[model samples]
Target: MKRFCFTAVSLLVVPVTILVAGPAGNGECIRTPKGDITIHIINHATFALGWSNLTIYVDPVGPQARFAHLAKPDLVLITDIHADHLSVDTIREIITDKTLFVVPPAVAEQLAQPLCQRSTVMTNGQAATVLGIKIEAVPMYNTTRQRLQYHPKGRGNGYVLTLADTRIYISGDTEDIPEMRALKDIDIAFVCMNLPYTMTVEQAASAVREFKPRIVYPYHCRGSDLEKFKALVGTDLGIDVRLRDWYNK
Candidate 1:
């Protein structure tokens, strides 16, 4: 994968090799009239996004080795208090003084004072602007009775980021809740699925089918059958199911 090379002042796009080439590299980028957003799929639920001059890390967890090659984050977004999504050790290793942590209230309550002091807490239906990008906190929870304890309502957050005209939805550990199915005009969506923890592949596909994001990438899915997900929501429905290697070798 090529390095994310762009200048905020110049807005110059380097050669096609710059950021994941034409959907054939580590990730993809969308160039809109206002700016560009490049997505880097790290591991698990962790992802690094390059938008203009800012580097945004979402649900970043795991070892420091997983993120050695990337730029230091300008902003970090934590969706839940789960260890997989929010790691204080990992945060200590990657964050700088300027890196602001964006999290929901549930996550805020669980974080230590050092983290909370620098964190911006947003609740469901709340919006905030960080690094000139609009971020809205959406609720993520389990609608299924048995799985309710795994993720109760208002405990975690799914997020919608508006970059130029593009809207990217990041589904933090959740089932097929009404909030997810009710989203509108999502250009890119990162959805989670697995047994016992989140939704099944069928549930993930069903939510994606209803929302109809232009492109959908299934992440945080270890044991779930992605092939079945693709078949269930075929291209005929006009939704592109993008399969990425979210788990390590």
Candidate 2:
């Protein structure tokens, strides 16, 4: 991979307000043209972000004992039925009468009674508009033959959300599939990298190099060398890598 050659002066200036919102704390929002995108990092593989009244909680599990400050999600997205991604107890705690729950079919089957009433089931290639945000479901899975059964093709989904003019991609548990590399004009991306569940740091960096995004946040990456991830992007791609301490445990 070629080292990033752009000078510091050439890089686009991200406003101080956007960066001031430290990884920890409430009301720490990133102001965008669409609205304020506030992020709260609870712990490993669990975080919450809200934009324009549309709150999105991803993989909302892990140490539920400490998430008292999290607001109820307007939209909850569960990528899979894994305990880290789908905690019935945590979902139940945050769910309200109006929350629009989005999950894969596997997860939807796990829900019982009233929780199922307010949920939307989406598979790969499906899409829906929830709270004015256009959500498109894309395929997410592993290509390595041995690991194919973990996340079979066409069973799970990675989401691409278009909010106002910003396009964001949230890669659920997946390897560096061709479909992800073919994505065009992605403004922001939240990618995953972990062993035995998702791609390696090199694979994630290669995918980002192909489909460049304005900004990239590496989350849901546990027990992996994140410095390698940052170095790969800094030395190979034009994509700006924003590091957040989501896994400080």
Candidate 3:
């Protein structure tokens, strides 16, 4: 009986150690009042959202990206035709017959052949439901006069995904637009802040503060000061500013 007891304890110890040492896959699963969400940051402006097995890839790019390890996406959303946002090669590599492609009109126009068949076009303010998730296309554009032509309003989109009562905003590539500030009841937000195309760190923080998402992940901030973002959200509004390794090796 004592031998059997020792053997049982040894088996439990091995499993526990493996669990403790295992790679904490992708991003942590966040439990909000609405539902559970797992965010996988792939690089600047690229991420995968997993709610159950229905994975959603947003702005997938990066030549070295490996989707083999990731859950097969039921739907993929491309905000624009920018190289960082929509790479035809990358999309072709990851797309399966079951995958549904969602994109703005500008991106839709660029699609060819079979890809066009699976594509859904959405302009600003339009809404569509795919794979049990409701997607609202919000305006994403440059307000700066010099950069106005980069992303004209109504040409690109920032998506608002409503999944199981949770409202998640993905600011594709935009400045601190009025629509962003006007948003309410946002559970999670993935806001972008980079120079030449989108808002600065200050602008991103200000917009986030106005909307007051329960949690905000500062993504697509390639050449911006992310520390400033954390400092801006420090201890006031109770907004959780999560920092993931979306950049660097």
Which number leads on lDDT? 1
Assess each prediction's global lDDT (C-alpha) against the native. Answer: 0.81, 0.74, 0.79
lDDT of 2 by residue, 86-187 (tens): 889877776778887777777777877566666677777777776776777778898877777788887777887776666778898899999899987787
Global CA lDDT of candidate 3, please? Answer: 0.79
RMSD of each: 8.1, 10.3, 14.3
* Colliding residue pairs in candidate 1: none
> What is the per-residue lDDT of model 1 for residues 1-249, given as tens digits with 9 covering 90 to 100?
212211111111111111122451445676555666788889889998887888899988988988887889998999998889988889889989888878887777766776677677777787776677777888899888889899988878898887656678999999988999998878888999997989999999998999988888899898999999999888877787889888863
The pairs that clash in candidate 2 are: none
TM-score of each: 0.88, 0.85, 0.87
User: What TM-score does structure 3 among the candidates reach?
Assistant: 0.87
State the lDDT of candidate 3 residue by residue for 1-249, as single tens digits.
Answer: 111100000110000000011233665676644445777778888998887568899988866455666877889999988898988888878878888877887887777756766766777877777777777888999999988989988888898887776778899999999999998778789999888889899999999999998889999888888989889877689888887778773
Better of 1 and 2 by lDDT: 1
Candidate number with the higher TM-score (1 or 3): 1
lDDT assessment of candidate 1: 0.81
